[model samples]
Target: MKDNAKISSAVIKRLPRYRRYLSDLQKKNVDRISSNELSNLIGYTASQIRQDLNNFGGFGQQGYGYNIQSLYNEISSILGLDKDYKMVIVGTGNLGQAIANYTHYYKSGFMVSAMFDVNPKLIGLRINDIEVLDYERLEEFMQDNSVDIGIVCTNKDSAQEVVDKLCAGGVRGIWNFAPTDLQLPEGVALENVHLSDSLHSLAYYINRNSQMKDQD
Candidate 1:
């Protein structure tokens, strides 16, 4: 792999999509693929694919293209999907429960070890066999368990506080579903999944396409 710091975020973001397509190809028993062939399937230009991949040591050969399974495995390793991550979810609300269920079904290395919530009704409730513990016990749980990631499903008001506690407790990363942005101390990674922003972007494209159709 090349120097990670020098790689553009755009290239990094495209890695997962590349891996997904490669996975699909592998399921179909594809042994290798040329850049042009992969670009047709993934919608990226062949040159773009080659350039983006070149940032990560150029997995493709000049004429042999790329080994399908090898590239898939390499990209997965690059994205850190090869390792296991034990996570704790803060806030056992509807979204939190949905995430817990989704993670339970996902056959990946990510596992939700525990969940926390402030609601009395939700506390002690089990989702996918993972019990929701009281928020007050979060600190104690953190001290006792080795958590690799923290999932913030709380409201904007409580998100930062939950993140602070998670960071203090030594979680290496945070997957924030909160509507607001959060600050993190150096060395702790953060990935924000703002559903509203995505919905708004969808709305924009929908309206834009409708207007274009009307113009015709």
Candidate 2:
């Protein structure tokens, strides 16, 4: 077993990509994979893969390569996906509803166990078979359901308040969609997804490609 806290954040970030690629290889009946093969498949250098694996102790054979199932299990356990994570969504707006309905999230190890909203009309509504409970009942719901993660899709102004309530209610992880900076307490993990930043970057790439074509 490895200490997840001790692992570099960069390595931790790449674990999900590695897991997905390995899963694809398994589906293709790949029994063994070399670091070079993984590197090519994932677009990472061979040496980087070896170094990442070395951090968790070498699992690959000297010449034979790594067993697909063994490597998958090792990575899965390291990333804490071996066990299912129960999550709740805070906010029942368009983005929140879409996230609740996203089938791919369920295919992974995360489960959207519940949803919360401040709107009285939206409360008690069902989205994708998950009941939308009142945000006022967040503490009770969290205690009753033992939610491990929270998806914050509230407006920028209320996002911090919602996070504060979530923290007080015992959430360890938060997937935030608000475009505001959040001040999180210690031991709580906050992952922000900035839609505006992504769109801006996409526009930059489009312009860059156009300039490249003009040069050609």
Candidate topping TM-score: 1
Candidate 1: stretches off by over 4 Å = none
Q: Write the per-residue lDDT of candidate 2 for residues 153-198, one digit (tens) a residue.
A: 9999999998987888788998999898899999999898999999
For candidate 1, the per-residue lDDT at 1 reads 64
Q: What is the lDDT of every predicted structure here?
A: 0.95, 0.87
The segments of candidate 2 whose C-alpha lies over 4 angstroms from its true place after superposition are: 1-3, 103-105
Model 1 clashing residue pairs (backbone): none
TM-score of each: 0.98, 0.92
Task: Give the C-alpha miss distance for residue 135 in model 2, angstroms.
Answer: 1.6
Worst 10 residues of 1 by lDDT: 54-63
* Per-candidate count of clashing residue pairs (backbone under 3 Å): 0, 0
Report lDDT (Cα) of residue 6, candidate 1: 90
